[model samples]
Each structure stands twice: as structure tokens, then as C-alpha cells.
Target: MSRLPHRASRRQFLKLGLGAGAVLGLAAAGPDILAFASDVSDFIRGPAVPDVAPTQLSEHVWMIWSKDGFPTPENQGMMSNITFVVSEKGVVMLDPGGSVQIGEMALRMIRTVTDKPVVAIFNSHYHGDHWLGNHAFEDAYGKELPIYAHPLSKREIEGVQGSMWHSMMERWTNQATAGTRIVAPNRTVEHGAELDFGDVTLRVHHYGPAHTPGDIAIQVVEDELTHVGDVAMDRRIANMDDGTYVGTFRFYDELEKNASSRIWVPGHGHPSDQVLAWNRELFEGIYGNCLKAVEDGSTMEEAREMVLADPRVAGKAADTAGFESNIGKYVSIAYLEAEREAF
Candidate 1:
């Protein structure tokens, strides 16, 4: 709730996006007037980002988020986040950005770290914010690099229309092209699997139906690194649009410790380990809010209102709606995984 002052008005932002001069001038104006710019900068580190961001998180890992148009991307293209780790096998990347352009930038950046081929590409989930840029990166690095995901991811990629695929790239990253067509997963596992990057071992944990049916959590086998795709979100509302609320509770419980990780990489936001316990608490709280609504015989819409009205949910209402828009969708999805029937 404690946020920095906002810099530009919406109208001012729109105008500044038209060119660079206005944006630069606006950034120089005053502290309050620069809040929005600072917020956007904190959102990602690339292109127009401030000079303060440290491009490297460590000798082998990176924290990355890609957005274009921040420009036209607000309405189209993609806003993506990625994590890169260099292992003796090669550089293994988790989740490509929203578009090929963004993905390409990520790839190039990875090259900056090491010339090793991108041996493994992990699609954190089916979402574009996480995986749409697969094509560009795959073509450059070779699709045979072996895509990894939950079984459903491969099915979604190969299915006709692959409806989610097209819409996500087009709307989120604004990149809708044949090259963006996704390739199904080559490796699929349930529960958890460990990937050995020669010198480094990575543990990928799959929790059923949270965020997406294929939601998985990755942790550096022995180091202090963990990637909790969308299961553990930041101040930015978690994207439950895919129907993971009920399962998210179970998923949250699985991550009971963070002793193994010194740095936590969320699907978005800066990496930190402090979120382990906090994320667990947040999920429990969200699940409780939704369960109470279900107990009250509230309709999905009413359930949303009830959840939003709770002090726990009130502050996050705006972010919560990002996932609650299709209340019925979430309930149906969560119901499938709920321990007890809510309806």
C-alpha cells in the first residue's frame, strides 16, 4: 500500500509514448511527476529503463522482464519475465518473453552471459507472458533443444487453433505470426523432476492445476535459487484467469521452506527469498476468502464481491479482478481440485 508518488497523468503518459522528448522531459520534472516513470522502470530493465538497474543478479543467474511500447505494448504485444541460468550443459532459460522481439532480446542477453547454446527451454506455464516467444528463440537456438512442461502444455501447443496461443501473443505481446506458433513439450512430468545442467542441478516441481494446469516451480538443486512461476505472485495480482485458486492452496502448501534458495525469482517482480512464508500466507488467505463466499451460497459474481470486500482482498481488488473476471471459470477450475465440494 505504500507506493511512490505517481509522475504522469494517464493523458500525459499517452502523449509521452508518442515520442522520447516528452518522456525525458517528464522524467526530469519533479519527484511526484516521476513516480509513474519510476514504477514502469521497476517493472522491467531494458530499453528505456533507468540507469540504476543492475543487469546481473549473479555470475550465472539473471532477473529479466521485457515490455515494449510500455509504447504499444500496454494494448498489444507482450510483457514478459524470464530467468537465465548458465550451467555446464549450456544456458537454460525459463519462460521466454511475450514476443519474438522480446524473446530475441532475452536470447541475445543470454549470449552476453555465455555463448553456450540454449539447451533447455522451460515453458513455465501455457501463458504467453511466460512462453509465447518460444518460436523466435527456438528457431534461433533450434526447436530440438527439448521443450519441457507439464503434459498438457504439449497438447495445447499441438491442438488446432491453440486458441490461447494466438490470443496471448497477439494481445499480450502484440506478436501474432506463424513463427510464434508453439511446439508441444518434449518432456513432461508430474510431481517434481530434477534437471541436471551438468555442473548445476535444477529441481522443477509440478503442482496440479494452479495458475495453469501445468504450473511448475523450479529451484536451483543446491544453490539459493527458486522460480515459482505464477504460483507465488507479487504485488501485481496473480493471474488466476486460468482457474487455479483451489489448487493454488495445495500448491502453496508444497513450498513450505526456502532454506535451499537465497534468491527467489517469481514469474514477475524482483527476486527475493522473503516471499516463501509470505506467499504461503497469501494463498491461504485467498483460498479462505473464496471458500467463505462459496459457503455463503454466493454466486461467482457475488463470491468475487465478497472476496473483494474482505479487508484482505479489498486492497488487492484491482489486481484480484485480473483473475476473477470469469468467476465461474475460476470456481469450476478450483472445484475440480477442491478437497470438498463448494457448490
Candidate 2:
């Protein structure tokens, strides 16, 4: 069989091994069970997404906004925004997207706005939703394309984090992101590093760990706009699995002190001047109460009640995506962090 992109060939190799093991496990299973398994295998394949037009946010920055906040088969894993900067030199991509299909769709949209090729790519973090689309861009642009990320992000993406995300996205989208292979960033960018692309310049900003240890925000100096990545979301709760509330607060402070971009672009939401403020208030509402609860020796349940009752958090509950299902976990994470700080 021919080797395919997105590691479909490698996946088949692994499936063969698993298939041998399944012989024993499914020895007693009826025909119905086998039929269901066959259906699942068929569902693993997905096609390209429909072309989505890019919306211009600044003079040079354009964004292909994703309507869905979470990955679903119907949306085919196009749950993250794809932003790019057009310059005299060429185009610079910020978080290409979540999968090959989404990336291809973004490429089609890019043609509508500008004919220049994508010169460089910058990944915000290690999350698959943010960078899995690297496969598409690298394929289109060639192997020599410069994909940039923080050192830690590059390491993580080359390690288990890369494979983990690839699998997780397949599971989340029911394999709608089937053909996406791991394409880690080839170049690394650190805080304070600046890339001058003729007409526009992008400055890198990484303040410890906010969304992830490797998260890097790119600042467009000419446009007076900054792509904050997952560090701060516009109206959504950022995933804190690899992050800390304290660190997030500190990141916000450091970002404000340094980069003063008029607009902030997030990975999951629209660009806005109030992006940082909106996320800060919501985080404080959740983490502040948790810290107070820890100081008072209150239980986790009590801390959750306080967070829910917080006007800042409650007000956004109706509009926030995945709020009801994820708030409990976020509150728990905050409570644990608060406890650690108190001690």
C-alpha cells in the first residue's frame, strides 16, 4: 500500500496489531458487534471542509472566524480561528487551524484576499486545535516552510503531546480530522524576538505560563493588534489543564505592561479591544472566590457556589460556550491552585 499524508499508513500499521489482539476479545461477539466496529472504521475518514471567507480585522491582519467553540463532527474540527498577516514580503499565519481540511479551506480563503504565498507560520501553543493544521500549510507551501513556536512547544509537539492531540482530535470529531498528521514547528521563537516582514513587524511575547508553558502571543506592531492565543479568550473559558490561575493573572499583567495593542485576537473567539479585560474579570471571579475559600478553610463545594454566584461569571454564563459542562472542572482547578498558594 502507498504511504499517505497524516500518517494514515502508520495508523493502519497500528490497527493491524490491535486487530490481532481483538481476535481474542471479540471471539464471543455476535455479528452485530462486528458490523458496528466496521462502521466505526469507515467513519474514521473525512473530507475537506467548505471554504470559509476571511474577515479583515486590521489593515493587514485577516481572520477566518470559527462559529463553533468546540469540535464536532458536523463542523469537522474547524473550531479554532485562523488568522494571518499580509505583508509586502508575504503572508504570516497565526494558528493555521485544527486540521488539514480546515487548513485547506483557509488557503482557499487566503487566495480571495491576497495572492501572496504564506511565508511563515506561528503556532500559539501545543494544543492540537491550534496547530494541527500545520500539516496542510507545510504540504502546500513545501517542507522548507518556516513554522515557528516556543522551544517548549516544539519539544512537546515532537513528543507525546503531538500524538496525544492527534488522537484526541480524531476522537472528539469522530475522526473528522482523520488525515491530519503531526507537523511540529520547525523554528522556535522566544519572548522579545521580533520578525520584521517588510511592511509589518511581529513581536513575540511569552510570559512564563498562562494557557500553556509554551504559549506565545504575536504582536503586530503596525496594526496595533495582538494575537493572544489561548492565554486570554474573548468570551470563553480558556482550558487550564496545563495552566494556572496565578500564572494567567501574571501573564495579563506582563502583557499589558509590555505590548499595548489596541485589539486582541484569541484562538477561539473574535478579535476585540476588551478581550483581555473580559477574560480577566471572568477568571478573577472564579479564582478569586476560590482563593478566599481556601483562606477561610471552606470546602470545594462552597468555593464552587461562590464562583457561580459571582456576577461576572454568572453574567456570561448564558453567552459563554461550554460553560455549564466545564465550569465545575475550572472551579476545581482554581480551588486546588488556591489551596497550594495558601499553603
Candidate 3:
């Protein structure tokens, strides 16, 4: 893997969403609920369930645990990966995983870190698993927390939220519709921004035009901890259908080359330095085969079939629900690069 250069053009990438029926709601457990909160807060073991709501991740940071976890199978995907960063000036959270219960617990944990109040939050991208928790935050902290995102992030997430809610409403009888809404980013950032917390500085890199138009990674600059969002998925396969491949791969390559930090956290999986390579390889294989199928005069449908012909990629595609959505992204991006001779 190599470090990425500046983006060549505007691009938006969205990681696949949890099937509407597979979604979970945040814990709405009454404040008096005890039992698990102490265990979760204590961090006594392996992925605590029946949690105390919020689990600590770093000194002033915590990971919100939905009692049922993410809606996806094994129920431990990105939706369970929500983490909150608290500082004296204010608190900043990244990827507030699905479930209002989890969101509220996250808020409770933020209280543990500091009494300054939550000042803001940012979504890694528009995936419902990441931003659906916004409603909980707003209800608890109000909508003025200055939700920040890329300009396109709001539109993409909102659209998905509605569509996903409808999908869930159709399946689980609105189990997925409760917290769904088109929450927008009040503050839009371009390129990068630096946020300070007493002596700690979180370096935010808007690395999208790959993961999503508004995709960004937050790094604990002093700690050398970089949260890569979905871009550098630590172990899971990278999603490329939202019209990002070349730029993502290129940017990923550049990131590999330029990033010297340690402890890379992903939107979903466990953290790792190898995430850069693992993600790049997966991206390379899928995008490569997708291009080949297209070049062979295959229709998008046929191209998708061709993708299934390759066992490695076929396995990757299995977790994703939208075939055309995936293939179309490759087609559109390839068409544009050829049009501009970006290669």
C-alpha cells in the first residue's frame, strides 16, 4: 500500500449499509438500569454485552455498546464500533453506531470524561450505522452540537436513512424506522481541520472522493492514533461501489506512503497497521476484476456474474446486497478516468 495524493476530482464513496432488517436501535434503557453498566464501564472482558452502556476505549474516550449490538449477523460489525472522544473544552465523537440506546450511553460516558459538555461530532461517512445515532445525541445535547461533515455527506446519509428506514419498515415492521432521519452536518469541512482539546489535538483529514464525498479520518495527533473510518477498513473488505476506486486506491496508496502513525482504527474491525495493505489488496482485486468484466463487453449484470466467477471477490460480494450498485460504481468511475485520461 502507498500513500495517496490529493484527490483528482470530487468523489463520494459509501460503504454498504446493514440490510434494513438487520439494523438495531440504540438502548432506551431507563436511567435506573444497573447490572451491566458497571461491567461495561469497567472493561472487565471481551466485547461486553448486556453492557453498562458506554465502554471505555482510551483515557477520555469510550465505545458505546448497543445491548443487542449491530443489526448485521454476528451482530458485531461497524454498527458496534461506535467510539466517543471526550475533552475538557468539549467532546468529539466518531461514528455513533446504530441504536438510540447506544447513543445515549455514549453521552453518559462523555459525562465521565469531562463536564464541559459535548461540543461536536463527525460522521466518517453516510452509513446509517455511523450516523443514525445522531438523533440520540441531538435529543440529549440538542441539535446545536455543530455536526460536521463534507457537503455531500448530509445528502448521501439522509437519502440512505430514508431508504433504509423504508426497507426496514417493509421487513421488520418499522423496527428500523424509529431513529432514522435526514440529519445534516451543520459545519462542512474541506481537506482537513485541526481540533484541539487542552493538550491533545485531533488531526482530521478529509480523505474522501474515495469512501464518500465527505469521508474523513480523525487522528489523535499526539497519540499517533488514526481513525481511518471505512477507507482503511482494518480487516473487513473495503466497499467500492459508491463511485470510488482509482481515487481511493490511489489515495490509499498515498496514505500508505505518507502515514507513519501507529494504531489505525477502522469503522468496523479491530485496529491495525496492516489495515492499509489489507484494504488495498481487496480494493485492487475487486476493482481490477470489475474493470476486466466491463472491458470484455459484459453488460453490468453479466459483469457482476463475472465477478462471481472469481472466488475471492465473489466471497467479498456475498456480504454486499446491491450488485448493480457495486458494478455501476466501477463503470462510472472507469468511464470518467478514461474520459479524462486520469490513468
Candidate 4:
């Protein structure tokens, strides 16, 4: 995978100042370095991530990624990719962010690129890490924005899931989530619905259930860009706690049919079809192995061992330290699902 020019430059900068000067310089930089350093720290402890920037993926499509890892106080609850599309009508945002602070940052970044108002927001899923940032938008504009999501996502945001996410925000972000509230999507979109934003048209497609029950992918019709929210990840193991392994494989097939030629912006990680394919292959292989183990009457622990024994799976675990646990969890989920289906 080719590195972005901006990311390569930041790597060079960090590499050049690896001594005492680096420490002193970072100290002088204060809060900015602390934030930047926290992002870098994800690499050593988990996955290396480039600094967030409003990078243009296509003509009018731009994205800003958050640090790689679970949301935490040090990172200010910014752990998902926030994207926006600029059209003559207005700016359309996807997954505002995880907290008010992150949302404010996204708003500032958007303003830096375009003066147009954000007319619509899309919560691709029900996860708070993707939409809790709605608080910042409402607080900033002093008006409610038209946030859209699948019916399941809207329901989850209004029920126990909403309260659970609110508690998670407070726990993970300390006081950063104080003013944050569950802002449910005002409008609901079903499968194969097209939303016209004047110059740009987004076709919303819900490819069954994958990452979450409400998972939906937005296809930018003109640009052939698809924002697949957490359905796939780049060089990282996806969370399956709220998802199903077989469902992910099904979603991958749908993505291949619809978005094979398009640029895919994931909920986390860099945008690339190769990464998407990698995730698909990972899920396919692991799920297949788990099914075989289940048919062979292996226990969950035995299925986990069999999947981990694969060189590809082992390599991924080595590359991503923090995700090692996710792999085990995924195998367990797959085994349990396969067992239930068999019975």
C-alpha cells in the first residue's frame, strides 16, 4: 500500500527528531504535540495512524480520520473517520464524530475547506463513536440538522442502546461527553433509497446486517465513492461483538457487486479497495475455518486455536497487537452462531 504524501512527511518529521531535541521540541509544542503524540502512540501500542487531515479523496469528497484505537479520554473520543462531500447545494457530512470536542474539530476542518453550510448529516450506524458528534453541530449552528440513518439505527439511538452509548461516552471521555446527548436521525432511509443533494446524489444501501444491525453504505453516484461505515477496516480486525461473521461475508459480496470499481471510505482506517478486500478475505477465511471446526465437533476454544494457527491470521495478530483479542472474540462468535444455526 502506498502511503499518502502528507503521512510520509509526518513520518519523516518524527523520525528526524528521535533524540533529546525531539523531546524538548515536543514539550515546547505543548497541547498540539500531546494530541499528535497520542495519535502516534496508537502505532506502538496498536496500529500506526497518520495525522488527521481533510484529505480530498475525489473532486468534492474529503475525509478526516481519527486515531486508531478505542475511544479514550487522552484521544478525546475521536476514533472514527469523519467525511464530508461538497456540493453546490451544501456540504453533506458522514459520521460527524464520537464526542462534542471531535465534532467541533470536524466543523472547524470543514469550514476551512468550504464556507457552505452542512445541510445534512448521516449516521451510517447506531454506534455512538460514529454519530454522538451531532451535539457539536447543533450547538454550533443553533439549529437542528437533518440527520439521516436506517430505521434500526434511529431505534437504537432512542432506546437502551442510546443510554448505553451515553454512559460509554462519559466513561471513555471523562468530562468531554458532558454536553453530548443522543441526537437521533430525524429522517430514515431504507435500502436502495437515493438522497439528492442537488449537485451530488447519494444512494443509500443497507446490505443486510454486518458490523451492526443498522449498517448502511452511502454510494456517491457521480463520484463512484462509497462510505461503508465499519463494514470493513484497513489493516485492522473489525469488532464483531455487535455483528455477525457470516453477515460480514454477505456484505462484502454486496460491496463487490456495487462498489468494486468505486473508492470505499471505511468508518475507520484509510480508504482503499485493497484494504476492503483484505478484510473480506480475512472474514471469509476465519469464518470458513470456524464452520469446519464446528462441523468437526470442536469446542469454541479448539475453533479459536485452529483459526489462529493459520499463518495469515497469526501475521495479522502480530501486526495489530490490540486486535488480538478481537480475533478470538470473532472466532467465538462465529462458532456460537454456527452451532445455533446447526441445531
TM-score of each model, in listed order: 0.70, 0.88, 0.65, 0.82
Off by over 4 Å in 4: 1-52, 142-144
How good is model 1 by TM-score? Answer: 0.70
Candidate 2 lDDT by residue in tens digits, 1-343: 2222454543564365533223323635877665644443433446779888899999999999999888988998988899999999999999998887788888899999999999999999999899999988998989999999999999999998987888788778766777676799999999999999999999999999888999999999999999999999867777998999899999999889888989999998888989999999999999999999999999999999999999999999998998999999999999999999999
Rank by lDDT (best first): 2, 4, 1, 3
> Which numbered prediction scores highest in TM-score against the true structure?
2
Of the pair 3 and 4, which is ahead by lDDT? Answer: 4
Number of the candidate with higher TM-score, 1 or 2:
2
Q: Is candidate 1 or candidate 4 better by lDDT?
A: 4
Q: Alpha carbon lDDT of residue 50, candidate 2?
A: 85
How many clashing residue pairs appear in each of the predictions shown?
A: 9, 0, 22, 0
Which portions of model 3 miss their true places by more than 4 Å? 1-61, 64-80, 109-116, 158-182, 257-259, 292-343
lDDT of candidate 4 over 1-343, digit per residue (tens)? 2322444433354455342223333645677675655444332121112236699999879999765657766676778889999988999988998766678788888988999988889999888889988877877665567889999999999887877886686567543454455677888999989888888999887888899988989888898889998888876778788898878888878877876546889888888756677787677667777888889998888888888887667667766525665777778888888887677
Better of 1 and 3 by lDDT: 1
lDDT of 1 by residue, 1-343 (tens): 2453366443344433422222323667788657745554333222222111215666567766533212144423444457878888898878876555556667767766678888888877776557756766777867577778777766666563255555444443222222344455677755567778888887877767877777778777656677788777664456566645657767766664422577767775556766555454555555665676667665556655554465655555454324445434444433343326563
Worst 10 residues of 3 by lDDT: 8-17
Better of 1 and 4 by TM-score: 4
Residue 301 C-alpha lDDT in model 2: 99
Supply candidate 1's per-residue lDDT for 267.
73
Cα lDDT, all candidates: 0.59, 0.87, 0.57, 0.76
